[model samples]
Every structure is written in structure tokens, then in C-alpha cells.
Target chain A: MPVETIDRSATDMKAEAAQVSADIDAFFDGLLTPVQDGRERLFAAMRHAALGGGKRLRPLLTVAASRLFAIDRDRALRVGGAIEAIHVYSLIHDDLPCMDDAELRRGKPTVHTVFGEADAVLAGDSLHALAFEILADPATHEDPWVRSDLVLELARAAGTSGMAGGQMMDLAAEGQALDLPAITRLQQLKTGALIEYAVEAACIMAKLPADARTPYRGYARNVGLAFQIADDLIDHNGDTAAAGKPTGRDAEAGKATFVSLLGEDRARQQAQMLIEQAIEHLADHGDEADLLRGIAQYAVARNH
Target chain B: MPVETIDRSATDMKAEAAQVSADIDAFFDGLLTPVQDGRERLFAAMRHAALGGGKRLRPLLTVAASRLFAIDRDRALRVGGAIEAIHVYSLIHDDLPCMDDAELRRGKPTVHTVFGEADAVLAGDSLHALAFEILADPATHEDPWVRSDLVLELARAAGTSGMAGGQMMDLAAEGQALDLPAITRLQQLKTGALIEYAVEAACIMAKLPADARTPYRGYARNVGLAFQIADDLIDHNGDTAAAGKPTGRDAEAGKATFVSLLGEDRARQQAQMLIEQAIEHLADHGDEADLLRGIAQYAVARNH
Candidate 1:
């Protein structure tokens, strides 16, 4: 498809999705307002970390999935924002001096560079706790089991076996050569877990049909893989302006990556295949899955 | 009180609180069992940090407060374990190279020293999330609003304005000449917030009457301050063997502390006063507050 056509398609999807996006933003901005006590500064840091920049894709997925079950927008917004909070916290901690040591993220200075490493670490920790708190809020659940399960799901995702475990794997794998399966496993756990959580959480919160959950899991798995592959491509081939980060740094760091192992063309093909698989998995859901399908396509198609 | 009498009282309280301690160990042992997926290691780290430890005071506090309003023993155990998880996480993170840089905690190599800083940091983050997850579990909550509110309170305490903020102050105030109020405020937030959460969470879970809540809060606030002061005193007067870790390190580091500011005798007086206040605040709750009062007394009396 032509670049213009794809851009227009994305715009239309986002345009129709305005209510969900707006609610996500509002929920984030509202919950993050500083209290009168010294606690305000923490919320200020949270708002600073969460409110602006980045794609907000995870939250969007949440809102979209929640809407499919005819759940109210407000409730979805809280869940969506909660996911973003986890994502943002991971990014902040990942950027710290002891971790990725990135100076910038999403075209802005990383949290540590601005707040100092200690504050950044604590801020990330606080955000992680806040996400669970948001998900477990009485307002977010009509049923105690639903609330409890959501909290547990998110905890598992963000905890060691999910995001943190994946991160630990990345730390071990960095600057080391790895075979295809190993690399795939690492990326699947690292980047794929949270993305999968976003989709799974929405389905669970909306209590979607039992049959739909398995296929949606498959759809999410593909989207998650495609998302990481695209990231690999962007790291290799995209410009700083487009990618909003320094490209080619991954190669400089001697990190084993999809493109490095598979070659650019094959990597691109595999990503597209994953996107196709994701769309096919969603075929039974029809119009309710349209935006998700479009997003899957965009995940692989975008240069950034 | 005589040292012999203090030891006898400590022995009595520990015996009375033995079930809470055993229950805490059991819950953790069950929670940390390896799952089919590879998430076992993370919980392993959590179990390592949480299962074997000092007094298990935080969990005991939760149990005592829960008993105030007749929350079932099983529910109290879960909530108590949750509080211990949060406490353990804070301790693990605080011992990291970037934070307190301690080589020992709870008579073992600190989490960062043992697990590596990356895993240590992630473990702390995971435990924070898990704490909320466990508390928010429907199995632990007979009251949905109480559960949600407990999650919110713990989040605030552990997050930026409470524990994190107090930690930031500690990091900034290391060598500074802080006054009594400044020190008190810092300790209240840093050490007191979570203890306050433990008390309030138990009471909330128990569905205590509104009037009953205030005393618990008061009780927690006083004991919280007393704990910090006692900690400072331990660092001042106790030996490594007696204390289970290095002592006098605080003064050597020139860290602003209650003992440094007020002298040993005055600091002891302050701790005693706080403990008395903590006990007095339990007046309305009758014998249900016995364990709590004993725990408060132990706070001031324990060498380690």
C-alpha cells in the first residue's frame, strides 16, 4: 500500500478511536494530579513520566479490547492507563544508569537524566505499585474475583517471569551471540509479555467469550512478535527523526537481534507474516477486530 | 525495665504471635512454589528475601490489627504476608549499591549483593506489585471496598509521597544537619508510612468501625517513629553480633540520626514515649490490641 494510503487509514482508525484515546489521556491526567501534601511531588513525577509522548499503543489496545465486550469507556480508560503506567515505569528503569543507560527516550530526556537515578528508580517502582492500585480500585470492578484476577494477571506480567524476567534475559544476552530460538524466546518474553498482557487483560476485564480468548491470545502473540521485529528493523534501518531514537546503536552494541540474525529483508518478511497471522486470528471477530488488525499492520509497516 | 524482664516479655510475645509467624512462612512457601512456566525464579528471589527474616514484625502488626475487628485468621495471614512482602522489597532495594550500599541484611547477603543489582531492583519492583495483588485477591477480602482501599493505601505508602519520598529525603539528608522535626518527618514517611499501612490495612480488612480506625492509625504512627528511633539506637549502641549486622556505621557515615541529634539517653526516651503513645492509642480496642502493644514494646526493646 502507498504510504499516503496507510497514513490515511491510521488516521481514520484513530479518528474513530478518539473517544477511547481521550478517555485514556483524561484518566491518566486526572489520577496523576498532585495532592496538597508532599505526596503531590510523586504524582507530579508520575504525570511527568506518563502523560506525554510515546505511542500509547498498549493503552489503545486495552481500550479497544474493552470496548468489544461493550464495557464502559471510563472503566477501560483506567485499565488502559494502568498498562501505560507499567510500560512507562519499565522504560524509566530501563533507562537508568545501571541499566540501559539511555540518555533519551521518545524524543525526550529519560527520567534518570532529569530526576537523578535514585528518583527515577523509586518513581519506576512507585508507578509499578500504582498500576496495580489502579486496576484493583473498587471503581474498576463490579466483582471481587474480576478485580483480584486482573491484579494478579498484571502482577504476573510485570513481575519476574514476564517483563522483569525478559529484561534479565536481555541483560544476559546483550553483546552475546545467540541462536535463533534463544533470541526469539528472549524477545518473546521481554517485549511480548506486556503487550500480551494488554490484550489478555482487556479480554479478561470485559469477560469476552471463552472461545474468543484463545484466538485473541494468538492474535496478541503475533502482534507482540511483529511489534518487536519492527523495533529491530527500526533500530537498524530507520532514521533518528523517524524512530525518535538513535538507530544502528543496537548493531554498535553487538546485541544479537532479529535483523542481525535474519537479515533485513527476511526480518521484514517475518514481521509481515506475523502481522498477517494476527489479522487472520482476528478474522472471526469481524468489525470489532478491525482497529486491532489495522494496528497489527501498522506495527510491522511503520518505519518508526 | 530490666534486661531479663525485657527478654521474658519478648519471649512471651513471640510465643503468642507464633501462629502469625508460621502462617506467614506457610503462605510464602506456597506462593513461591515453582509454576510450570519459568516464573519460579522470581518468586524464589521473593521467597528468599521474605520467608526467613527478622521479627516478622510487619506481618504481626497486620495480624494484631486484623484481630481487632475479627477478620479471620486466614485473611489476616494473607494480609500480613502482603505487608511483609512490601517491607522485604523496600529492604532489598534499600540495600542496593545505589541506595544504602549495605553488604548484609537479615543475617545474609543483601538481595542486590546476592541476586545482582538488576535482579534485586526487579525483585523489589515485583514484590511491590505482588503485595497489592495478594491483598486485592478476593480470597483475602470479605469487603470489596476495603480491599480496594487497602490496595490504594499501600500504593500511596510505598509510592512516591510515602516510602519513596522519605527515601529520597534520606538520600539527600545523609550528611546534612537536620533538625528534630525534619528527622521525625523523614522517618515518619520513610519508615512509618508502610507500618501505618500495615495497621490500617488490617483494620480495614477486618471491617472495623470508623471510630476504631483512628486509634489504629495513631498507634501505627507512634510505633512507626519509635521503630526508626530504636533502629538508630541499635546502630549506635548495639554490636554486630548482638544486632545481627554492623552497628555504629550510621554515625561513622555522618548520617543525620536521632541519636546524633538528641544523644543516646534522649533518643531512648523518645522511643519509649512513642511506644507508650502507641500502646495508649489501643485503649478502645481492648485485648485485641495486646499483641500490637507487645509488638510496639518489642520495637523499642529489641537489640536487632
Candidate 2:
């Protein structure tokens, strides 16, 4: 039987987002259950980082996209959980003393601050491994080919040529005069790659042909860039609590970002244009893709 | 046709080790080739950490074990390369200022020391992702099940239940006395887990039945323990240059280890017995198992 499709209305978008958030929470709770006679502290740190707080946007994107193909919601949730693990691990490491040097995240103490730098590092590392482990398990998909595809795409999205590489560029960009293209490229890798993978994951799960996935890929690309631009706007606006991190750090570090390069008005306009383009890509699909369209709008509108 | 079996002579062990080392070097060279107009620094850091240096013992173990089932040498080499990537990434993170805080590794500056700590962290992160990516590729194995199996096992071995857990235990062991069993369990998870996975990967590649893999698993468990004991002994003896990193740190940290829990005499005796037991596990096999047996002996005998 085909999975139930969600409508594209604002109410459905809110409901879908909440549903994925709860599913992710439950999944992580079960996954991170205490290992008796094991490294309890490590598990604790992992729980703190992974389950502490987040909007679960990547997971929502995965489920929403999967809905278009009538893919199993449970499988989509698992893949989303894996992607979220990678995202949380990245944040944990990024908050380390030697990295972002931030003391707070999601309105809570950073992993390193709460668990010590060493434990935090190990926690992030373990989470990274856990993500791949989750995807490789047969439970993720009956077909080994799909499981391998998920792992392969995730690794590409998260590895040196992707998110990690983007981070390297971000670090290198510090105090350097970067043009719009350089900054665009940096965001594409640092944050965009994983976002793209989340959408692509659904295509893989649905076994959609390459041609069939192009629109979703395009949608993801636009959403990813717009998300980053909105993030820059948020930082420039200095709404610290809403951002869940210190605002104005980008400007403080003399780092060039969308808001800094183009005036705030232009940057905001660019983000809106990207979001329109993002929604346009999903026009071929009916109301089954409504949630995905809703999510693209949410990505730009979200304050935190 | 069955793959050629390696002989058990001392000369053959040396030759096999060198051959695997060369194969891994070539594989990583091709994998880490420069990306044009991309994050060159991150790639450089990855190359420095991965191709910098090591005994390639894990890869050799992978190759030797694969030989038992007459698996393809090139396929075995690719699997070995993936394992080596995991090993190198672990070492890179282990040497971080917040972890081991070591300046030198493999007779050269550690990743964190050469590249800034942030870059080093990202480099390690990227390498870890690259390992899974390599295993998930179709080129690694024609069977998707085999690829997923490799990914799953490696993740389990490297994640919180294994290496990361052990590292956490090690950190927690500081300034606290641990019993022999506790220390043994720690090493088992940390180093032993990956070594065991290296052997198990061959079983997966060969599509051997579970029962057929028992002896190899036993062999791996014993060899893994012996390898750790030897490392403890080397550290106890203050052989810094041979170890390629500072030795005697365990003693300085007041940490319990195989050598500390059991005096040097008993520790050496234990390692020797373990190696013998390891080799004995392969008694049911013919000359096809020679290299694995040789490796067990080398694990205890190697200075580094």
C-alpha cells in the first residue's frame, strides 16, 4: 500500500514538522539507551549532543520528499536520524575550544563545555560512526543496494569534499576578503551538501531514476543556499536567543557572508528569490510534495 | 581460480607486509589526488595524516585473512585501504591537543601540530567519512551486501561500543586506578575491535558462512590482545623512538596497563602465550593461513 500523502497547506507543514521532530526524538531515545557496564559517560555526552535540541529540518525534508514517492515513512525517519547525527556531531566539534570556541548551543552549554573537550571530541566521533552504522544496518532498508547508496551519498556529502571541506573553507575564509562566489561555494559545501543529500536520500529510497531526481536536487540546492543566506541575515540582526548561538560573530571575526557582502536588503531579497526557485522545482509534483514546498519556505522563515 | 597462498616463512611475512604497504600507498595516493579549485589545504592535511606513515598492520591483516578464502587480492587491498583510513583517522584524532596532546606521531609532527587544531580535527573527520565512502562504493565489491557488511562492521568496531568507548575509558582512567580486567576490556574495545574487524571483513568478502568464520574470529581476538600487550610493553620500556610517539606516558599518567598490571616479565609472557594461542586457532587451515600466523608472531615482535 502506498504511504499516506500529506497536504501542502501551512497547517500540514507545521504538523509534518512536528511529527518528524517527535519521531526523531523517539528514535534517538531508543538508540541511545544506556549500555549497561559500558562507557556510560560517552553515551551521556552523545545523548546530550544528539537529543539536546534541534528543529529536525533535515529529517523533515527527508520524510517530506519520501512522501512524494510513497516510500516507507519509517525508513525515511531512520535515514533522517542518521543525517541528524552527522549534523549534531559537526555542531559538537564546531563548538570545541579549538574550533568555534563557543560556550553555548541551542540555549545550552556546548558539548565540550559540559563533557570536557576530550569526551566531546570522542562523542562527536562516535556519533559520526553511529550515523554510518545506522544506514548500513539491514533495518534501514531490505535492499542492500539502497543501504549502500545511502552510505555512499552520505559519505560524499559529509566527507572532505563536502561538509568537512566546506568547513575548511570557512576556517580559511576567516579575515580573508572572500567574494560572493567564494562564500557561495563555501556554504554549498559546508551546509548545502548535507541538505542536498537529505533530499537525494528520498530519491534513492524511492529508486527514482536520475532524471526523476533532478528537480528535487535542484530544490535542495536552492533551499540549502537560501538557508545559509537567512542564517547570515539572522547573525547580522543579532537575535542571539533566536539563533541559539552568539550572533554577530561572523562580523566580529571579520568574516565575509551574504549579509556582509551584499547589503542586508539585497541579501534578504536573494534569499527570497532562492526560496521561490526552490518551490518552483517542486511544481511538477502534486499535493504529495506540498510538505517539501512548505519546508523550503520554512527554511528561509525560521529564526533558529 | 583460487588465489595463490602465501608461505609461512619469515622472509614471506616480511615480503607480504611490504607488498601490502606498497599497495595501500598507491591506493591512497590515487584517492587523495588534488581537487582543482577546491579545499586544497584540507586534502593536503588528509594526505599528510593518511599517507604520512604507519606499519600498515591492519591492511596486512585484512590481506592475509582474505587469502584464506582465495579472495581477490585487489579487492582485499581496497578493503585494507579502507581499514587503514579508519586507523589513520583514529590516530589523527587521538593525537589532538585535547586528547593525547602528542606533538609527534609516526616520527613526524602530528596532524594537529602540522595543521592547526581545527584543520586537524576536520581532516580526521573527513578521513573517517572517506573510509565509509570507500567501503560503500561498488568498486569495493560487486555484491552490495558485502559492501554494507563491511560498512556496518567497521562502524560498530570504530564507534562508541568500540574504539571511541575505549578512548573514553582511557580518558576516565586518568588519575584513577583500574583493575587488570578493566584495562584489558579497554584495550579490547580500542585497538582490538578494529583489528578484529579487519579479519572479519575478509569473511564478509568471501561470503563465508558464520560457522566457517569462527576460527578466523578466534584468531583475530587473540592477535588483537597480543598486539595491545606488546604495545603496553613497548611503552613500559620507554622506547619512544621505536614507538614513534612519546612512551612511558602511561606510567607518568599513573594509568594501569597490561605491563603495569602485570609486571614486564609477566606481560611479555602473556603476549607470547596469546600469540601462540592466536596461531593455534588457525591450526585447522593449511598453508593458506601461513601469513596470518606470521602476522601474529610479528605483532608481539615488532618494535613499533
Candidate 3:
């Protein structure tokens, strides 16, 4: 349960995670060319927001999950890129003046700060729409039911009841006490929902049996919670340079967090326990889930 | 072309439009119940925003355009509801304090004003996502190619380079005399893009031939322009009671418009011409295009 025993040096896993993240970037960069001349400017903004830096966790989760179904890299990458686009769009909108109002994200001025809020907002809206557009593309030739379910899953994940609703709760809970239950609910909705979507959609896209999907969903939900709690711990304990943004933001904002409510020691313990539970859900899938299991463990143990 | 001679009484047409609008509402109302109890509240927000009210122009455009292919009322109505959801989402976001800052939409308080800005923003975001979710539903069993293309069209119409892009231009161009071309581009991007999407999406959903989509797109673009110009004119000359909102908002905001740039008489003349051109594009399609033709004409002629 000790942090030192489980914590992996950021440098140890940084190379591979960074590679996966780059693969995601490259995948999206290839799709961004305008099919028509008039589309030039819009495509440029799409690239600008998309190519911006991040951990690429959601997309990575997607690719890893797809791999479990024995889908090849190319197909996984396309769907992964699409999920990342949605993730990027969410970040852009979250940074808007009316939302989180952060001036920085991914070690640079956020999209709104660079592009102006209206463009940032529109970029987010457009990119979110484009996610479904890409998923439903005829080139993918995914089954109609699969495509429909993907759209439905994503809409629910990103919608008012999903990430945004979680955001509302976070905002309302700011400067207030959030107990373990409230914290679980908040993180589950906000971050866990999308992560669950990424994993489950990958399973759905690969046409995995319903049995495979059910457990994968559980695995994903647990990993998502662990990932968020780790974020809270890091935000409290991480160095600003290593963390890529200011640390202790939650503390400064007086936001309710597992760390704040449960103490850093207990929070880290809970994260590990959740990660273990997550990996256990994938046991029936065997080594096909190794990357997913690796990432789940990494979620809690990574330094930044 | 005489303004006085045009039968300006849109009540009967409005009543008919309202019935179609009601059908669109009923479709979504019956369809959006969440499977999970926790999700139903958010789903209710989605339904509330979609069903609450609007001019229903976008849905009307969808139904009218699809009728051009054939009166496949079921598909047309579903697509119509989907398009209306997108339009409503845009309005909800556009009216936010960070955006247009309007107090009233469709004669009632804006969504953000009633729901709180955060919920309103999420509601809009969800609505945008849900638009695709609805369009891509398995129950609809729409062709994958058609659904994909429709998704793309909708994305492009809503994205940064389309409606969102135009909004940014308007924000930046406040108090400036955007040249005639600039004015056209702004309106086209801000309003025309989605209007085009509505019309084109309907045609695509109907499985119309590719070549046929071109004229419909043209018709949509033209009516989109006329609609904005007429909106400007109404903001100048229409009655507040008839319009169901305040008159003269554009002028008060120092926003550029066709009516503001040219004289009122010229704006009216231009709107008439655009509607005529919109109608002309439907020439080969004949009486099946009547609803579309009538709506375009009504767009310019309506007091509201």
C-alpha cells in the first residue's frame, strides 16, 4: 500500500506511453487534409486543436481494448483517433471562459487563449460532431448496429449527464466537502464515463461477444476511477514542471477530491486497489488484455 | 416583389408548420427515455431542450427537403427531429452570456437563463451529440453511407468553419461594416451552413442520387442567406409581438447585417431575390419541392 513500493518512475514508462500518444497524433494528422479547398481554414483549426499535446489516455485505452478483440492496428488506430478527437474537443470546451477558464493545458496556453473563446467553443462543438462523423464513415464499413451503438455510447458519455454533468457537480462542489461517495460519483461520471466509453466502444467496434463486453466495461470503469484518483494525488504531490501544468490546482480551488477527503495515503491505497480490481476483470481475456492491465497498473503508479 | 402585395399572413402556414413541428417533437419525446434511472434526468434535459420550442425552421427544412424525394414521412420526421435538435443546441449555446448574450429565444428565456449557464452549455453539448445519436439510431435502420454522409454534412455545418466560424467572425466584426461579401460569408457560415445541412441531410437520408444533392445544397444555401437577411429586416421592421421577441437587437448590438449595411428597402429586395433563386434550384424537382419553396418564401415573408 506504500506509494514508494508501487510508484513507477515517470521515465520508466514514459517512452512507451509517449510512443502510443504519438501514434495517435500521427493517425489524426493523416485524416485532417481538406477534401475541398473551402474547407481549408476549418481543417486547420481541427488540426490545431487535435495536434495539441495530451497524455492520449482515452485513445490509448481504445486501441488497447480493440487489440484484445484481435483487431489489427490500422482499424484500432482510426477508431482511437476518433475517440481522441472527442477527448481533445472536451478539453478545448472545458477551458473556455465560461467553463473551467484555465489559461493553460498540455503545457501551453489552452486553445481558447490562443484561438479566442468563440473559436475554441466552436472547435470543440465541431470536433465532437466530427467524432461521430468519422466513426460512421463508410470507409470503416462497420456494421450499422455497431455504428449506431457507438454514437449512442459517445453521446451519453459526453452529454449533460456524462462528463458535463460531472463538471457541473465538480463546479458546485468547489470549495465544499466531497466525501468518498460524492467523490466516487463525480469522478465516475466525469472521467470514468468517457474512459468506459473508449474501452467499451472498442469492444463493440471489434464485434466482441456480449460476455467480453460486460467485463471490459467493468475493467474500464475501475481503471477510469483509479486514473482520476491518481490525478488528484499527483495534482497535490507532483512537481509543476513534471505535471505539465500548475500543481495543487484542486487544493487552490478548494475542489473536493479523494486526496482532500481521504488523505493522500488512503487515496493512493484506494487507487491501487481499484487498479488491481480492474486488471482482475480482464483475467478471462488472458494476455490479450496485458496492455490494458499494464495501463491500468500504470494509471495509479505513474509519477505524473 | 411588392412587399404590401405579398400575402404576409403566415398563420395558416405557421399552423401547418406547427403540426409538423409537433410531430418532430413527439418523435424525440417518445424516443429519448434513458434505460438507467440516473440517466433519465439528463435525458429529460435533452428532451426538454429539444421539445420545449423553437421556430422549427430547421426541422421544417428537413421535412420539406425530404418531401422533394418522396413523402417518406417516417424517415423525414426522424431526420427532421434530429436536425431540430442540432439547431436547438446551437441556439442554446449561442445565447450564452459568453456568446450572443440574448435574454430571449423563441419568446421565452434562453435555456441558459432558465437552466443555469453550465447546465445549458452541457445541454447544448448533449443536444449536439444526441443529434447524431438520433440520426444514427438502429430503429431508423438508415443506410450506413447515407448516415455517414449526413453525419459529415451536419459536422461541417456546425463546426468552426461553418456556423461556429461565422459566429466568431460576427463577434470580431462587431461595429464594423463587413463588406457585402464579408456579410454574406458571415451569415453563410453562421446560419446558412446548418440550413444547408438540414436540407442536404434530408436528401441524403432519402437516398437521393449524388447529382441531385448539388441543387438541393444550392437551394439550401440561397434560402439560408435569405433567411438571415430577412431576420435582419425583421429585427428592423417586424413587430415584436409577431416576432415573439424584441425587435432591433442587431442594431442595438452594433452587429453588421444586410439591412444595416444597405437600406431597409434594398434588404427586402435582396431577400426576395434570394428566395426566388432558392426556388429556382428546385425547378426539376417540381411540386414535390413545393413545401421547400413555400418555406423559403415564408422565411423572407414571415413577420416573425
Candidate 4:
């Protein structure tokens, strides 16, 4: 049965987010149970970073996208969890003193602040390894090909060309004169890659033909950009408590971002346009894609 | 036709090491060429760490193991290169000030020392991602099952129950009391896991049946432990320039190591005994296993 129908209001997405957050947390809790060794600190730090936080938007996106093809829910969640693992690892490293240096994440002290830098780094590395482990396990899928493809997809999304690469671009851009295109390209690599991987994973799981992915790619790309812009806007205007971390960091770092390059009003307009375009990519589907549509709308809507 | 024969001496293995080292470095250089984007710093750090440093013993072990089965040479090297990437990434992170806090690795400044901590972390993260990316690529193995299986094996070697978990244990054991068994288990996870994976990757690439793996794994286990003990011995007795890094770190930190627990003479003898035992695990093979035997001898021979 369909979980939610078309024309669903914003309240429906919140409920779905809550459910996904709980599921992902439970999955990590069970998966990260400390082995009978002295590595309890590592597991604890990983749990601290990965559990009980975030909107679970990436996993939610994977779940929502999987609905477009009627894929297996549990399998979809597993894929989503791997992607979120990558997301969480990046966040842990990003919040390090050498990086963003922020002490708060998810409304609490960051991993390095709570666990110290060594454990924080190892915890993040463990999570990074976990992403591939989860994807490669037969439990994720019976077909080895499916698992291998997912590993490839997620690895690319997390690697230098994707998240890490984007991070490098961001680091290099700090206090430099990055124009509109440069900032857009930087954000595309840093955040857009994983967001695209979320939906692409669903496509891979469903064994959808490569040629059939154009619309989904378009949907994912548009939504990812829209989501990033909304993030910059929130970082500009929203309070730290609401953001679960410090806000206006872009301005503080003197870094160029969507809001920096396009001005606040135009950036907001661009995000709205992208969301509409993202939804337009799903015109081929009906009620089955309602969740994705909700997610696209939610991309910009999260800031409000 | 064979690389070397059963009676090959330490000089022959050194030549082989130099060859494998060059091949792995070239592979990384080609793979890590920075995009036109300004992420050169990240790529530079990765190249600085991966390109010119270690003995490439892990990849040599991989190459040597693959020779017994006549696996595709380039494919075997790719697998070896992937394994070496993990080794390099781990070193980069381990040398961070929060961990070993060392300024030197491979006779030169460590990644964090040269590139700043943020870049160091990103470079290591990129290399970690690169390992999976290399394994998952169609070039690594034509069969998806083979690629997927390789990923599962390497991920297991690198994850919580393996390398990362071992690092956590080592961190917690600092200046604390750890007995012989605890220290053994720690080295097995921290260093042995990767060394074992080096051989396991060869078995995986050769399509050696799971049931046929007992001897190889036994060999791996013994050689890995022997290698660790030899490493500790080197740290205990060898000078900085010879070992390529600071020495006597374990005793200085009051951390119990193979050398600390077993004592200098005992650890040296234990490594020698383990190397012989490792060689015996390959008793079933004849002239084809010559390199493996040579490596077993080389493990203990390195310290001498």
C-alpha cells in the first residue's frame, strides 16, 4: 500500500522524517554495538555522532526515491543508512578544529569536543569503512552485482571528486574571491554529490536501466542544488539552535556561498525555482512519487 | 618465467620491493591527478603521502601471493595498489598530532606536518574512499562477484573489528597496563588485519575456493604477527633514519608492545619462530611458493 498520497501537506513529511530518524538510529545502534574489546570509546563516539540527530533527510530521500520504483523498504533503508554513514563521517571530520572548528553539532558538543580528536578521527574512519561494509554485505542484497554497484556509487559520492573533493574546494575558497559559478561548482561537489547518490542508489537497487535514469538524475540534481541553497540561506538567517550548530559561518569565514554570490533574495528565488524544476522531473510518475515531490518541496521548505 | 625462485636471498626481495613500490606509486599518481578545480592541496597531500615513501611491503606481499596462482599481473597490482592506499591513509591519520603526534614518516615530514591537519584529514579520507573505488571499478576484476567479494574482504579488514578497532584499542592502552594476550590481539587487529588482507586479496583475485584458504590464512596470520613483532624490534633497536620514523615510541609512551612484554631477546626469537611457522603453512606448495617463503624469511630478516 502507498504510505502517503499525493497532495499531502507538509505535516506528512515531518512524520515520515521522524519515523526514518528512529529507524536509522536503531539500525546504527545495533550495528555499532561495541565488540567485546577496549574500543568502547570508538563505538561510543560513533554512536554519539551518528545516532539521535539530524532530520535523516538523506535516508529519507533514499526511502522516498525508492518508493518511485516500489523497491524493498528494508533494503532501501540499508542503502540509505550507508549514505548517511558517509554523511555523518564527513560531518565529524568537518567539525574538527582544523576544519570548521565548531564545537556544537546536532545541538550538542561535536565528536572531537566530546571524544577528543584522535577518537573522533578514528570513529569517523570506522564509519567510513562501515559504509562499504554495509553495501558489500550479502544482507544488503542477494545479488553481488547490486551490492558492488551500490558500493561504487557511494564511494564516488564520498571520495575526493564528491564530498571530500568539494570540501577541498571549500577550504581553498575560504577568504578567496569565488564567483557565482565557482561557488556553485564547489557546493555541487561538497553536498550535491551525496544527495544525488541517495536517489541514484534507489535506481541502482531497483536495477533500473541506465538509459532510464535521466529524469531521476535531473530530479536528484535539481533537488540537491535546491537543498544546498536552502542550507546556505538557513545558515545566513536561521539561529544556531535551529540549525543545531553555529549559523552565519559562511560570512564569518568570509567564504563565498549561494547567499554570498547571489544575494539573499535571489538565492531564495533560485532555490524555489530549483525545487519546482526538481518536481517537474517527476512528471512521468503519479502518486508513487508523492514522497519525492514532498521531499523536493521540503528541500526549500526546511529553512522556513 | 617466475619472478624469483625458492632460494632467493634478501637482496632479491629488496629488488622486488623496489619494483612493486614504483608500480603502486605510479598507479596512485595517475588516479589522483587533481581536477582543474582548486583542490590541488588535497591531491598534493595524497601524492606526498602515497607516492614516495614506504617499502610497499604489503603490495609486494600481494604481488608475490598472486604469483602462485598466475592471476592477471596488472589486476593483481591494482588490488595491491588499493591495499597500499589503505596502508598509506592509515599512516597519514596515525601520524596526526592527536594520535602518534609524529612529525616524520618514511624519512620525511608527515602529511599533517606539511599540509596542515585539515588537508591531511581530507587526503586520508580521499584515499580511504579511493580504496573502495578502485576495488569496485570494472578494471579491478571483470566479474562483479569478484569485485564485490574483494570489497567485502577489504572493508572487513579496515573496519571496526579490524584496523580502526585496533587503533582505538592502542589509543586506550596508552600508558595503561596491557598484558601479552591483550597486546597480541591488539597487533592482530591493528596491523595484522591489513597484512592478512594483503594475502586474502590475492586469494580473492585468483578465485581460490574458500575451503582452500586455510593454509593461506594460517600463513597470513603467522607472517602478520611475525611482521608486527619485527616492527616492534625495529622500533626498539633500529635508529630513526634506518626505520624512517621515530623509534622507541612504545616504551616511551609506556605502552605494552610485543617487545615490551616479551622483552628484546624474546620478541626477536618469537618473530623468527613465527616466520618459520609461516613458511611451513605453505608446505603444500613447492617451487611456486618460493616468493612466499622468501617473504617469510624476510619478515624476520628485516630487523637483522
lDDT agreement with native, every candidate: 0.78, 0.89, 0.75, 0.89
Clashes of 4: 0
Candidate that would win on DockQ: 4
Task: Give per-residue CA lDDT, model 4, range B1-304, as digits (tens).
Answer: 2445544645566777788888988898899886667898999999999998887878998988888898877888999999999999999999999999999899999999999999999999999999999999988898898899999989989988899999999998887899999999998899899999899889988888998877888899999999888888999899998998989888888888888788889988898889888888887887667777888888887843
Model 3 misplaced regions, further than 4 Å = A1-16, A27-49, A140-145, A252-254, A285-287, B1-12, B27-49, B252-254, B285-287
Error of 2 at A263 (Å): 1.1
Pairs that collide, model 3: none
Q: lDDT value for candidate 2?
A: 0.89
- Name the candidate, 2 or 3, with the larger DockQ value: 2
Chain A of model 4 scored by TM-score: 0.96
Which stretches in model 4 have alpha-carbon errors above 4 Å? A1-11, B1-6, B9-12
Instruction: Quote the lDDT for B260 in model 2.
Output: 80
Candidate 3: C-alpha lDDT? 0.75
Choose 1 or 4, whichever is better by TM-score.
Answer: 4
For candidate 3, the docking band is: acceptable
Which candidate model has the greater DockQ, 1 or 3?
A: 1
- Minimal lDDT window, size 10, model 2 chain A: A1-10
Clashing pairs in 4: none
Instruction: For model 3, give the interface RMSD.
Output: 3.9
Model 2 root mean square deviation, Cα atoms: 3.4
| Chain B alone vs. reference chain B, TM-score for every model | 0.92, 0.96, 0.89, 0.96
